[model samples]
Target: MAFFGFKDIDKLSEVDMAIYRYIVDHDEQVPYMRVRDLATGAHASNSSVMRFIHKIGYSSFPEFKVSFQTENQDLKNSNDDILTMFTRDAFPNDIEKTIKLVAHLMLDADNIIFIGMGASGAIAEYASRQAASLGFNCYAMKDPYYPLVQQLHNTSNNVLVTLSVSGKTIELVEMLNNFVNSADTVLTSITGNIESPIARIGRYALSYNVEETRIHKYYDLTSQVPAVYLVDGLLKELHNQDVARRIN
Candidate 1:
């Protein structure tokens, strides 16, 4: 299941395991079922159901249900179908607002630092190269242990953009933590889960809220397309701002 991996499953207690199995068995009915319903079906209490949801990285039952429904829908549709739905229905006003705001920050900042690990790292690299092509001083930091913050002398002039699908990567979180007390630095994040740790640290956060997918319990197969779209939007916004400035 997309909800929990083998590592997460091994950490579950007996009661939690029962709840997990119940969820897997009743996957179709889960999105429609209430917490009490799941508790009853799993022979566990409502609190146990809530705890299971938290253990699986979701903050609430509704969040878990929404993610579950999205995952199910994704499985039922082809890649083309998913793309059609996204293009037709996605990109609400809040995302546009965040994009505009981040674009302003990018345009004002003297430097942009894009950081991520693994798949997100690749996305960060793409963003850095794209921004650099447009004449923005940008760097992509894929190395988790790189002393990124220490190398910067002027935090106020730097916009730190972090890309993460989970928003819970230890290295990325640690990197953000270093900047948490530095109010002068503008921290921006694009993540799949907005309520995640890295999201909380960001001064501005944009979440696509897509269903996360993984393979072999370790390889993250979660689509980065949403994040990429956000980056593209940000870059385009930056370009528009530059054009308007030149015109003025």
Candidate 2:
């Protein structure tokens, strides 16, 4: 039921709802069932069915099947038994603050790098592309295996923008715990926990306000989109600043 609240959400359509239900209902059976069987049984077409699975959180139908069957194999577990807090209305303040801090960081930084994994990784990639387009020294590292701690320990100049909805990503935490208080390096974190290891260690922290819906594991973004919104706003702010400097 982790993805339940999202089932009938305006954000997701009927087919999406059906697909999620099917996954949950046949949690054990899905891993052995063929896509053709799922499509036929679910009364959905195979192509669209496959796409929907990926959209919900699976990389492919096979992965989705394995994840479904292996729910018992999860390493980390959630504490909240009943969903709460994050919904589509997680508040706008978190995102808004992200915009302001990011712009300021860019104006002050020699370079910027955004790092993340999972949905946060997607966000980092989005921000990196935007920053690069604006001519900022921004990169979103795909090397999740390498400890960001070692990288931060060796690098100089600029800023590091990291994303973690839970604010508990291990590699990222390593980086923050290692560097945060030692040198006055700039770090901006977008996460759910204001007091998480990474956020606590950051020079500036932006928490994505998430509302826990009845059935979804992810919190609603009233707090999260701010990181993305901040990237857009920072670009605009820099544009205005450049124009003003030229006029002056």
Best by TM-score: 1
Tally clashes: model 2. 11
Candidate 2: lDDT of 111?
66
- On lDDT, the leading prediction is 1
The C-alpha TM-scores of every prediction are 0.65, 0.53
Question: Which residue segments of model 1 deviate by more than 4 Å?
Answer: 1-92
Residue 69, candidate 2: Cα error in Å is: 38
Q: Model 2, residue 5: displacement in angstroms? A: 22
* Segments in model 2 whose C-alpha atoms lie over 4 Å from true places: 1-98, 147-155, 182-184, 213-226
RMSD value for candidate 1: 16.8
Error of 1 at 10 (Å): 49
Give the lDDT of residue 137 in candidate 1. 93
